[model samples]
Target: MYSHLLIPIDGSPLSMGAMQTAMAFARDAGAEVTVLTVVEPFHIFTVSPEQLQAKRGEYERQARAHAADLLAAAEREAKLLGVRCEVVQVESDDPYLVIVETASKRGCDLIAMASHGRRGIAALLLGSVTLKVLTHSKVPVLVYR
Candidate 1:
């Protein structure tokens, strides 16, 4: 019953598992999948002006490249399944916000993402992005742990 599916990837194995789940759903529904990856914004306030500029530029470039690679992989998988798909790369410090915004902007009906399965101090330190997305996203979310 879903029209558009949004799958967020971070190049992690956990994220890949979520992608597989999204793929299965897409296959069943004959829905188009939009794969999104957010490249975090580079923080520059703490560094010298020159350093900030260089670091920011480098981070942007790396992010773009990484996103491209991930998108390509996702496309390959989708093509194999004979499914229509789109890839979107976003830049933001808050990946959850970016994911939700992109899903809304792209008119996705569902979001599929992986949980890192963090616990205790590790969870506190890392502050789960999946948790944020689950808590805030307006669309239906299918989290793959």
Candidate 2:
């Protein structure tokens, strides 16, 4: 039933696993794929405006480049299955919110993402972005671990 699928990738091996799963699903369902990458915003409280500007720009550039590469790779895989695909990069400090919002705005029916598999102290301190997404998202989410 999912026609427009949103796949959020962070260029990690875990996320790559999710991408593969999403690609397979899309191929079977004849759905279009929307690959999204989010770049966290600058921390204004920690850094000055000027400093944040340069650092944010650098990070954004790197994030965009990485997203482009990921999208390209995913696109190649989708092409082999003869499926349609599109790529988008979003800038936001709240990755979960951005992913949810983008999926809603794009009319995606489902979100397919990879879990980093964080646990214990790391998960507590860093928190789970995928968890936040699952909690906040109104649409269906298929998490790939």
Best by TM-score: 1
In model 1, pairs of residues that clash are none
* lDDT per residue as tens, model 1, 36-100: 98876677663324336566677678768878998999998899888899998888767889889
lDDT of 1 at 111: 92
Predicted candidate 2 versus true structure: per-residue lDDT over 19-126, tens digit per residue: 888989998998998988775555646433433556667765765776688888888878887879888877776778988998999999999998763233545776
TM-score of each: 0.83, 0.82
Give the number of the best model, judged by lDDT.
1
lDDT of 1: 0.82
* Global local distance difference test of model 2: 0.81
Q: How many clashes in candidate 1?
A: 0
After superposition, the stretches of candidate 1 with alpha carbons farther than 4 Å from their true spots are 44-54, 117-123
